[model samples]
Structure formats: structure tokens, C-alpha cells
Target: MSSEAPDPLQHIGAALFRPLGVEGVYARTALYEDLVERLTAFISRQRDRSAEILRFPPLMSREQLEKSGYLKSFPNLLGCVCALQGTEAEIRAAAERYEEGADWTRALAPADLVLSPAACYPVYPLVARRGAVPPDGLLFDVAADCFRREPSRSLDRLQSFRMREFVRIGPPEEILAFRQHWMERAQRLAAQLALPCRLDAASDPFFGRVGQVMAVSQLQQSLKFELLIPYYAGAKPTACMSFNYHRDQFGVIWGLKDEAGATAHTGCVAFGMDRLAVALFCVHGLELARWPGSVRAALAL
Candidate 1:
């Protein structure tokens, strides 16, 4: 007899996304679409500031990634592009081995690109090409389909997810203020949605002992914060939003300087669109109509 327990979230109708024979990749239903649309609309209205909007591709240059310092911190989660690199006969043999349930990826060679890990990563280098930032600084509304190697059954944690980020790049004081404003605004946004949430100092899920040290230092410096919401039964809340302050790291890496020739600081507020939608469902149940009137009006759903 099989002893595996059933997934507790299997019965979450309408709002639940179904995995497409993969551990983390999911197919969103109409209910999920409704949630994302409303969420996007609300963000657009609340974010009334002027900024450059950019939608980046899912894959980014591997060289750019290396320069971004992502490989140094998150080598485990990096998804490099690999493709079959052999003649017809070798490809046929590889296909047969794959059908026989053998390790077929051995024939693959790394490509020049890697799946993009964050929405704001690619923007830094591009901005650097334009030379020093202006006195007013730069604000970007960026969105991307990000990828990671995490494989989990939990609905909140996925290998592929959408991230919507409002990134600020400029002098220390301006960018810092931008992040602080969002931190406060994010809490109010959560309250408006009626989602029970809290802001907690956090760190990235770095790899290995060295990574642990980095994580600790990050927390100590208060460089990261997350908006956490209770999403599942008998479990701690999941982080649906992250606010990061990358002080001069990206600026130095990409040669992004302020008008005064000092390295520019960067800060971003990222929204986990999928996770936020699921949190709303978990908190209010699958029936959107039954949700609080204020919440419904806020989302305009």
C-alpha cells in the first residue's frame, strides 16, 4: 500500500493552479486570471508615479548574469540553457536513452543564455550604457517571468513564477527613501486587501555555509524585507512580496554612477503575483463574490 499523504490544497477549486506534470510549473485557470488582472489593475492605480516600464524576456545573457554576481550567491538555483549538441545519429541515440528512462541530459551543452532569475536584474546593465544617472534618478516598472531550480509541492513555492518590480536607481538618499516608502505602502496595500500580513526582515535562500554567512550579514544590515501572509493550513505564512536594497553592488558591477560620480544605490519592491493571488484565495476562500466588499472594490473584480 502507498503511504504518501494527499496534498491538502488539491481541493481548492477555481483559485488553485494545476501542475502540468511538473513539480512547480502550473497552468492557471480562469479564476487565477481574474485574480492577476485585478491585482495588476490595483497596482497600476496605486502606483501613480511616472517611470519607465519594461518587460524583459524569460532568458538573459549568461555573461550578464555572471557580471551581476548571481552565480556567486545562487549557483544552485541558476537555470542555465542547455541543448543537445551533436549530429543526427547522436541525437537519435540520446532520444532513445531518454525514452528508456536513462539520463539523457548528458548530451546537452550549455548555451549562452540562462533563465532570468529576477525581474530587475537585466535592467541595471542597460541603464549603465546610458552613462551616469540624472539628478532626479531613474525609476523602472519591470515585470518578468523568473525561473529557479526549486522543486516543491507547496503551491506558494514554484520553479517558475511572475515577478512585478518597481526598481529605483540613484543616489543613496533617494533610493533609500524609495524603498522605505514602498515598505510602508506595501503594508497598507495588504491591509486594503484584508490579507493578514506582516513585514519581516529577511534574507535570500543562499547556498552552503558561506552563503549562510552572507544571509546573516544581509539580515544584520536590514537589506531585505518581506510581506508575509498566511497561505496554508497549520503552516507559517509565505512571503508574497520582497523589498531589497542593493547598495552600490549592482551600481558598481554595471558601472552605474550618480551625477556626482559616486556609485548609485538601488532598491526594488517586487510582488509575487501568483503567490499573492493564492494568498487572497486562501484567506477569503475560492468564492470571489463572498470576499469583503472593500477588498472586492479595491481589486475591482
Candidate 2:
């Protein structure tokens, strides 16, 4: 290995964070909340005007996850929710002991929940159970805490974070138009933020041999594109947002049918909330004082 000293985030911050890299950040007494709040409002504005705002718990049912095919497509990266089982008294005692430099023996079992990996994962069933999707469609503004398994540490990649998504399910044309519209809107949003960015077609890093083939096929097929920017001040750009078209995949699986009995088309514009914060920090700097006036006002910083 032609190795230099290891990347600091690699050894130090597995999930919570390290200093040299920012896979995670703890913005404690800092005033980034104003920026985060402004960003959240901005995301909601991008959704359909009539869209319902939905908030989901960080963990989801494993059965729900299975039906969603998350286990199949990304088993390696999935996080199952579990709890440490014990009597109430035992739990209290264990907690007390743990605080005293001891380890608890009761381990968590793989019960029902799993850490949700995306903001839209819980949406399919919610729409499906609502009976037939209207001819017009259903739109939602969803934000959730998400978790993922990662191999390397970079400013862009976080193991646990937040995501906001604008989701739509309806006619194919509507879904196509929604994704296309966001792709264009993203350009404007980036400009408004005054952050330099680029749009590029991207593919998920699938697993193993068959996955490699599928990833290559996906790249050739051009199913997804991302809006990337310089978060780490390096050559490789980080994806701040992505526009995805799922054709009939979720429609077929979740039975999200339009009024005409056609499998409803699904698409989403997803923003990596934490990554956006990172991008803003990297572009604008640690001090909020030097931020561009318009962007600062937009963020209410």
C-alpha cells in the first residue's frame, strides 16, 4: 500500500464523527440551526403545493422493509432496529451499571424495526393502503432520520443522517415531468445558494458480481442523475440532491394504481440534508459572518 497516514475520519469517527473528516458533525451550541431551519423550509417549498407533510420515525418494521425489497437490493447497507430485552428493574440496573464502567450483558434481538434508509421508504404502503391513487396523483413532503453502512469516511458519506424528499405517485407523464422539473430547479437552487455545482448521471454501488453487472447496466441505461458540488474541496464531487424515476417498480410491488388501473408511476427529488449542511459549511466557511448576503438572507442566517 502506497499509504500516507490514514484518513482521520476512517479510524476516529465510525459513526458519530472525527475532526479531519466530517462524515458526522455535532453543531452543539453553534447557530447552524437557523441555516438548517431555512434549508428545511426551502425543501418544503419545492414540493407540490397541496402535498401533505409527513414525519416518520427513524426506525421501520422489518416486514415493511422486506416487502419494500430493501433487503434484497441493499442488504449490506441495511440497519435492523433492535432492543435490549430485560425486565424494567433489570434495565434500570443495567443502565446504572453501564454508567459505572461496566458492560451490559443483555443484547438486543432483531425484532420488528429497522433503521429507515431513506425518507420515501415508508411512503409506498401509506399510499397503497389509501386505496387507488387518484388520476392526478399524490405528493408528499417527507423528512426522516436515515441510516446506512459505509466502508470509507469522506465529508460526503455519513452512516447516520437526515434526508428530505418530495415524492410523487401518479401517471407516467406526471412522474417524468416531476423529475425533469426538479433537475432544472436544482440548477436554480444551487445558483441561488451561490454554490458551484454540476449535474451528473450516477449509479448505485450494487453488491457482488451480478450487482456489478447491474450497476454498469444502470449507468448505461441512465436511470438516475445527481446534482453534485464541492463539499470537500476535492476533485470528486458530492451529490447534494438526486432525481429518481422508479417507473412501475414501487407501483407494481405496493399496488399503487392510478384510477385507470395502471400501475402508478413513482418519482422523487431527494436532498441529503446533512450533506447540504456540509456543502454550505465548506462553501461558505465555518463563520457565518462571511456568507453571501442573499444566501444568508435566504437561509436567515
Candidate 3:
């Protein structure tokens, strides 16, 4: 019955992750894998209702991400592609040597792809190149192993995580209105799940001194709001679902124009699938039937 958000790490198991050492959760977790199955199923059902169901891997072109304004705003969180040089046999020997506690470079001969920080960044260009989307616009359902570096290792905040997003592209008003509509819908949906959630304006945790100014501008413009559910002992609450309205940002950058000969106003509803599963587990315990019927059915608990 607590209205406060749980301590970001309140639900994450300490002992469960202790064996992971310094790298910790970034490397692996059995619990996350199990929840992955549940989340994939949930997203699949929702995607079928409105999305084209495009799957994107955990990589984006470094150039594309930079053009998307990522480097300036969140340089600290980005995971860049890197490579190591050596003969093929030397590389093989290094790989084997690393297993034996010898130094082995974790870089590739040529960088493959940069790790994606969000699930939807790749969707914009895909829709753009398709050439002339339907008058109604396009919906993309995408998931990825997103990477972001945080100063803290608290369970609520992670360096690497999975994210699933539903993106909408089209006319200015239609996309803006889509975000506005879903904000309300998420509240009702939260109620059904019996999870106390709040609609609060928010922004990405920008890095460095300049980032402070950027964060201020973001809030002043009211560009984002997250439906937060408490996860840990913290009072501020964890954001579970986010409704973001990117006005002309992605459109201008990716050429996602609409029928009106205007750059599309884009929006997305992002759900922290893993965090949500954690919230439900903590708030309602592992027992599925004991929970509210609607919530149980929604997650197929």
C-alpha cells in the first residue's frame, strides 16, 4: 500500500548476483532470462494489435546514433564499437589465453556495431526508407539489449538492460495526440494492474556539466513523462512506462515526413519490461491467482 517508489535495488537480489563479481548484472542473470520469456510473450500480444512487428538487434550505426543527438546529451552512457588487431591465429590464441587468466583484448579487428541505448532508435529510418508510409502512419514494435552506463549500480538503474518500445510515426498532431492519449491509457492500465503509478514529467539522465542545461531545457519543454511504479526503498519511484513526444527531432533527423508535407511528430510508449515484472513480484508476491484478476490476465500470471 506504499505510495512511494521502492528503493531502486530493493527488489534485485544481492546474493543472486554476488557470484557475478565486478561486472555484475551486466554479464548475466537467470532471473532476467526467465522474465525475458514472459516479457517477449506480453509484447508479442500487444504488438500484433497495432504494430508491424519489426525486430531490431542490439546494434545501431554509430553515425546514426550521433546524428540522433545521443553523443552530446548522453555521451557517458553510450557503448561504442571497438576493435583489436592481431593475426587470426594470434586472436585465437588470445581468446584461449584469456580463458586461462591471460590478457586478451576484448576488441574486434573491425568494429561491428554500436550497442543500442533504446529499443526504438532504429525504427525511424526503417520507416523512412520504406518510402511513403500509409496515410495513417507506421507502428514499429522493437526490442533490444540496450546499453547505458550509470554512475550507480543500484538495481533500479542498470548499465545494460532490455527494452521494448512501440513507436508511432505520422502527422504532427496525430503523433502528439497519440502520446497524450497513451499517457491517460497507461494510468488506467496501471490501475487495473493494481500498481500505483504516477504521470510525472521526466528526462534522460544527461551526463556532464552541459547536460544539466539540456535536462533543464527538456523539462521546460515538457517533452517526456513517465508512469512510475515504486520498486525499491527510495521515495522518488521508478519509471515503468514512458510516453515520449519527440517534436520534429526524429522527423527532421530521419526524414519521417507526413502526408501534409511536414516533418512527422513522433511518439513512443516505452515499458521497462523487466522492471515491471520486478514491481509485480514485489507488490503482489509470486502468487499469480491471489492478485487482481485483470492484472493477472494482462500478464498471463
Candidate 4:
């Protein structure tokens, strides 16, 4: 027998993901889905019970996205919905061009919606519509099928993935405290899963020269942190979770305010569901039954 170890990423791809002939997109196996469900349940249990649970579709209003400043900050990663417009003849022409292997997508125009880039993006607008937040603040558990335009062959970097976030909005002090609490809690959660990990200050993939400044500011302010775990041998660790402090950015755009009439500060603990599952499989081997007893018990698998 060969002395080399089995490739965990390859094993996961074969057993868990069915590729759709697209980089970063796959149809997941039942086993994978089951694992995700367990993860979701476990993570949900960690949230404050008073949190309002909200689930959103994969699409959000394009206008809202523009308003949220994602367009300016991460335009390269944004995916907009587009469709053939004009008369039936125009639509037929576009379809014919597509069949002819021409650039048919040029005929399509931007629709009113865009694929949601993050699970928490839609929550701000919804909460703003509900009027001012209560004095003690608000907590929300939100989940969605999120999308990004970046395509990679890496199994852990899916272009279309599920994200779950626990969002907090209120006074700056409370928001900061909430992020700190989750930052510590995330480490414990990772330990329970028996995954080797590290926490590091991180920055978003902002776009262009202006974005470079913003990214530096984000890091200097300690506004973003990521919990990274190894997804493959010899490769840099992948970020499986993020803690972000928006610091009135979303509040100002969405008109969210505290009961005292000040703009609310916002922060979220985001779980990259697919990435986390990949980390677990990478660290624990392909068989769930053979995983560490503590991890199995923690996930209740």
C-alpha cells in the first residue's frame, strides 16, 4: 500500500458534492445536506432566544443593494439578475444567438433584483421599516442562499452557498459587546467540533484604490475578524466564519435607529455553512460515524 494519505478534499468532492460543470457550484449529496442541517440546528441553539428568526430568498432588491453601498465597495463580486427584454422577436433573436454560440447575454438587461451577497443585507431594510429599535436592542437570526461572482475550483469556496448570521443592532457599546461575545463563542464552537483553527483580523475584498483605503481602515478599526480552518493539506486556512462590526454604516443607509433616535450600530456573526461542513469533513475524515465522539455529540449527529 502507498504511504501517502488519502486526499480529504477529493474524498469530499466524490462523496458529498455533485458538480454542475461549473466552478464553485454543485448539487450537494443527501449526506452533506444532513450535515448542514445538524450544523444549522447547533448554531441556532447558541443564539439568544429572543432573536427573531428570518429567512430570505437568494434575491434582493437591486435598489437596496445600491443603497447599501455594496456596489461601490465590492462591485467585482456582485451578481446582478438580467433577462432578455423588448418584444418577443428580440427575445427570440437572443435565444438564437445563444444557440449559435454568440454572446447572447449582451441582449439581456439588468432586472430589478440581484443575488443577495450576504445573509444580513436584507434584514436592515426590513427592520428599518418596522420603526425604531427597542431600548435593549434587537437580535436576529437570519439565513439565506447567498451568491458571489467569484468562481474558484476550490471545494470550500462555493459561488453559491448558504450563510447564516446572527445580527445585532442598537447602541454602539451594545453592538461592540455583541461582536466580542461571539468572537469568543466562535472559538469554543470550533473546539467543540474538534477542528484546528485560528482567529485573525481580516478585511473584506474591497474593490479598487478607494477600497484599499477602506480595507485598511476596516483593519485599523478592528471591524472584521475571521475564524479560519484548514480545508486541505499544505494550503492556507479558509475562513469559515466572520465577525463584522458595521458601526452605523448599514443603519445610516437603511434608516435604522435606536429608541433614543440615534443611528443604530450593527454587527453580525456570519457562518459560512458550506465552508464549515468542508472543514469538518477535511479534519474528521469522510465517515461521520468515525468522527471524534465529542464532535458527534456536540453536533448531535
* Root-mean-square deviation of every model: 2.1, 4.3, 4.7, 2.8
Q: Which stretches of candidate 2 lie over 4 Å from their true place?
A: 1-29, 85-107
- Ten contiguous residues minimizing lDDT sum, candidate 2: 8-17
Cα-lDDT of candidate 4: 0.92
Q: Which is the better candidate, 2 or 4, if ranked by TM-score?
A: 4
Q: What lDDT tens digits, residue by residue, belong to model 1 across residues 1-301? A: 8898876666763246766888889888988888888998888786647789899999999999999989999999999999887899998898889789999988988999999999999999899999989988999999999999999888888899999999999888998899899999999999999999989999998889999999999999999999999876576989999999999999989999877898888999999998998888888888888999999999997
Task: Compose the digit string of candidate 2's lDDT tens values, residues 28-137.
Answer: 23344566678998766666679989999888878988998778778898888666667988778877777887776554457788899898989999888889998789
Global fold similarity of model 3 (TM-score) = 0.82
Most accurate candidate by lDDT: 4
Q: What does candidate 2 score on TM? A: 0.85
> Residue 250 in model 2: shift from native, Å?
0.5
Tens-digit lDDT track for model 3 on 1-301? 9998654444455422443454325443565455557656865665537777766777898878888898888888888777766788877786887788976765455464689999998887777787765678877787787877664556566666678888888876777888898898778777767887788999878888888888888899988999888753455688988988888898888887766667777889998876776676666655556877877677676
Clashing residue pairs in all predictions, respectively, total 0, 0, 10, 0
Instruction: Give candidate 2's whole-model lDDT.
Output: 0.80
TM-score of each: 0.93, 0.85, 0.82, 0.94
lDDT of residue 296 for candidate 4: 98
Model 3 whole-model lDDT (C-alpha atoms): 0.74
How many pairs of residues collide in model 3?
10
* TM-score of structure candidate 1: 0.93
Worst 10 residues of 4 by lDDT: 4-13
